[model samples]
Target: MAFRYLVGRGKDRILVDTGNGNAEYIQAFQSILSTRDLTLSKILVTHLHPAHAGGLDPLSRVTWVSSPTIMKHGHSPRGFPNLTSIKYTSLTDGIIIQTSDGDTTLKVLHTPGHTRDSIVFRLSEEDAIITGDTLVPHDGAASVVLEDPVAYLASLRRLDALFPKLAYPGHGDVVVPATDLIKRSIEEQMQLPERIIEALCSGGGIMDARDMVRRLIADAPEEARRNFTGTVLQHLLELEKRGKVRKRSVPKRVPSAAYEERDPDRIKGPGGLTLAQVSKLVKESRAKDDKVYGLKPVEKSQEKGKDFSGAESGKSGKLERSEVVQLHPAHRELEPLVEVVWSVV
Candidate 1:
C-alpha cells in the first residue's frame, strides 16, 4: 500500500507524499483539506517513485519539491520501474521550512537509501518524522527497497543518532518510538553479511552473483524479491573486499545452474492458479495484495510426474515450485527479472 501525508499549520498546508496516482486517493486528500479549509499549496515528496509522487501530474497548481537526484535524471532514474512526470524544486539536507508564523517547522533531511532521491521531513511540533521508504516499519519493511546498501546503512545510522521518537513512513501508519525501528533496520542490515556467509556454507561451488542471489532468496517473499538482489549484491561486494568470498570470473554474465526446484505446478498465484493464468486475472483485478502463506516442500515420495518446470529432476529436491510458492496479487505487475547481481565486474 501507498500513503499520502498532510502536514499543515494554521491555514497553510502541504502534502508529504502523493500515494499512487489513484484518482480517489487524491480526491480524498483534497477533500480532507477542503473540509478543513486548507488549500493544497505545496507537495514535498520523499522521492519521485510513482507510488509516492504519482499525483504530481493531476494535482496541478501546487509547488513540488523533491531531491535533486530525481530532477537530475530528468525525473527518471535508471532501473526505476515507473517514474512520475513532475516539475519540482530540489531539496537539501538540514533545510527548515517554517510554517505559519514560524510555530511549526518542517526539517527536511536528505536521507537517501531506498532511492537516490529519498528524503525525510521532521515535524518539529510533534517530533514526528515523515520517513518515505527510508525507515519503514519492519512488519511493513517491504518498502525498504535499497539502491545502495552501503549508503542505506549510513543513512540508517544517521537517523539512529538523531534520536527520533516517532515516524510516519511511506507505506504504513505511525511508527511510535521510531528509534526502535531505526535500530532494528540497522541490525538487520548488519547481519546480512553473516547471513550470506551462512548461505554459502550450505552449498559449495564457484558461484556467480546471480546464482548467489537465487540461493539467498529461497525464503524471501514477493515484496522482498524486488530489492533482494541489489541488497545481496552489495553485501557480496563487501564480503569480497574483506576476502571472505571471492568471485570466479572477471564478472561476465554466464549461465548458472538451477539452485531451486522449478516445478510449474509449484508456481501459483490468485486462486492457486499458474503464473500465466494469474497474469490474466491481475490485469482485470483491483486487488492491491492479500496475505500469502507458504507451505514446506512436499516429501520426496510425493514427487512424481513433476519435472523441474521444464527440465528433468530427481531426488534430493529440497522443494517443489508449488510447496514453497507464495501466491500474491501484485507479482504480475513486475516484468520478468533476470537481474545482474554484479555489474560484469
Candidate 2:
C-alpha cells in the first residue's frame, strides 16, 4: 500500500508521491480533485520505486519534482515509461517551496538508504514531514528497507535532529510525538545486527537466508516475510562487511574437459542413467537397510527418449552411421555417477 497526499488550497494543489498505478486509485484521485476544485500544479516523488512513482505518467502535464541524483541516474523515465514529455525539476537539500503566504514552506531533506534517491519533505508550517517508505510504521514498531543500513541509520539520525512534530509515513497512520517514534525506529534498527548474529550462532555459524528467516522470524505474519527477508539480508551484508560472516556458493557437478572430449556424442544429448539402472540402485540400497532421503524412482511417463543418427569415420577410415542417446534436460552435460547422495541433517 502507498499513501499520496494533496496539499494546499484550490488552484495550487501539490501532490506528494503518486499511489501505485491502478484504475481505482486514479478514479479516486480524480474524484478528490473535482470535489475540492483543485488543480494539481506539481508532483513530488520521494523515490523511484513503482509503488511511489508508477502513476507519474498519468499526471505528466504537471511539473514533477524529485532529487537531482535520481534524475542524473535516469531512474525517473524508467519508473514512468509513458511520460514521454516530462516536465521535471531537480530539488536539492534546503530548497524550499512556499506552500502559503508569510513564510510557510516545505523543505527538502535528502535521506538516502531505503533507496539511493530517497528524500523527505518537511512542512515546517504544520510541523510534519512526509517520509515515503524511508521509515515505515509496522506492528507498533517502525522499520525500513535498508538498501544501505549504515546510510539508513544516518538518515534516521538526521530526521531525529529535526524533532518532527508529526510523521506522515508511506504506509500507515501519521506518527505523533514523532521524535519518540523516530527513536524507537532507531533502536529497532540497532538490534538487527545482533539478532542476525544470534540466529547464525544458533544455527552453528552458517545458515542460508531462508533457514535464518525461518529460525529468527517464524512468528512473523506471512505478509511480512518479504520485509523480514530483506532485513535479514541487510544485516548479513553488514556482518560480511565487518568480516564476521562469509557467503559461500553451493557446489555443483560440472563436466570435465577430458570427459567431454571422450564422450562428445553422449554429452550432446541427455546423459543420465536409465530408469532401470536407477531402480536397481534403489533396490540394492534398500536391501542393505540404508536410510536414503530425497530419492524417488523415476516414472515411465516422465522419461523422455530421443534417437540421434550421425556419420563418423571409423578406425579403418570408413564413414559409418552412429547412434547416440539423447541427453535429458536434467543431465545434459554431466555424467550420472550416482543415483542419489545423502546430506547430513
Candidate 3:
C-alpha cells in the first residue's frame, strides 16, 4: 500500500510519498482517498524509496514534485510522462507553504542520511511534522537513517529547536509529543559516530562499514538488530563519503562466503579496505572467538528544568536509539554492543 496525506491549510490535498510500483499499490491508494472523498492536487515525494514513491504511477493528473536531490536520480516509471511536471523544488529552510486550510510551513530541514535529499517538513500551525525516513518511531525511540550525518544532525537539531507537537512519518503511526521524539532522534544519532570513533581510538582502529554494523548487531536487542544494521550502514556510508573512514574497494560488495570485516587487521589504519577484506577479518576473528569493537552506549541526560523532564529522564533524545538496533542478516555477534549503544544513547 502507499502512504498519501492531505496536507496544508485548506487541507489542500497533496499526496506525500506516492508509493510508486505496480498498479495494485496505486489502486489501493486511490481507493483509500476515494473513501475520504478527496482528490490529490499534487504529489510531494519525501524521498526516492520505492515503497514511498511507487504510487506515483497511478496518479495520472497530479503534479509531482520533490527535493532537487531526488530529481537528480531521474524518474523512470512508465506513467512519469503523464505527470504535469516532476519538478525539483528547493525547499528553503524555514520557508512556509500556504494552503487553503492554514499555512503548512515548509521548514526545509535537509535530513540527508537516509538519502541525499531526505527532508522533514514541519507544519508549525498544525503542530505536526512530516518526517520521511528521517525519523522512524519504534518502541518509544526515534530512529533515523541518513545519507549525510552532518546534514541529518543539523536537521534533527532544527526539529528539536522547532519542537513540533507531533510527527507523521512516511511509515507507521503518528508520534504525539513531536518535540520529545525529535529530541530523542537527535540524541540517538549523536551516539553513533561517537561509537565508531571510539572503537577506532580504542585500538579498534579504522574499520569497514559492515564490520561496524556487525559489532553493533551483536549488542542490540533481537527485534531491533535488523533496523540497526541499516542505520549503522547508512552512518558508515556517510562517514566514508566524508573521508572519516576508507573502504577497501571503491564500490564495495559482500562475498557469498563471509559476513563481516575489520579495518585494522585487513587494511592499513586510516587508509582503507574493501568489504571482502573486512569480511575475511570477520571470519578469522570469529574463528578465534574475539569480540569486535562496537558502539558504546550514550549516557542519558536529565533535563532538570523542562516540564517534560521527569517523564523524559534517562530517555533518549529526539530519536530513540533502542529502536534502531538490529542484527545484520549475516553477522550475529554484534547484539550486545547494540544494547549498550541504545542504553547509553
Cand. 2 Cα-lDDT? 0.57
* Shift of residue 219 alpha carbon in model 3, Å: 6.3
Q: Please write out the lDDT profile of model 2 over residues 90-173, one tens digit for every residue.
A: 766777765433244678888877767788999877899989888777652213445567887899999999988999988888
lDDT agreement with native, every candidate: 0.57, 0.57, 0.50
Pairs that collide, model 1: 266-321, 266-322
Give candidate 2's root-mean-square deviation (CA, Å).
11.9
Clash count per candidate = 2, 4, 59
Q: How accurate is candidate 3 locally (lDDT)?
A: 0.50
lDDT over C-alpha atoms for residue 193 of model 1: 80
lDDT of 3 at 104: 55
User: Higher TM-score: candidate 1 or 2?
Assistant: 1
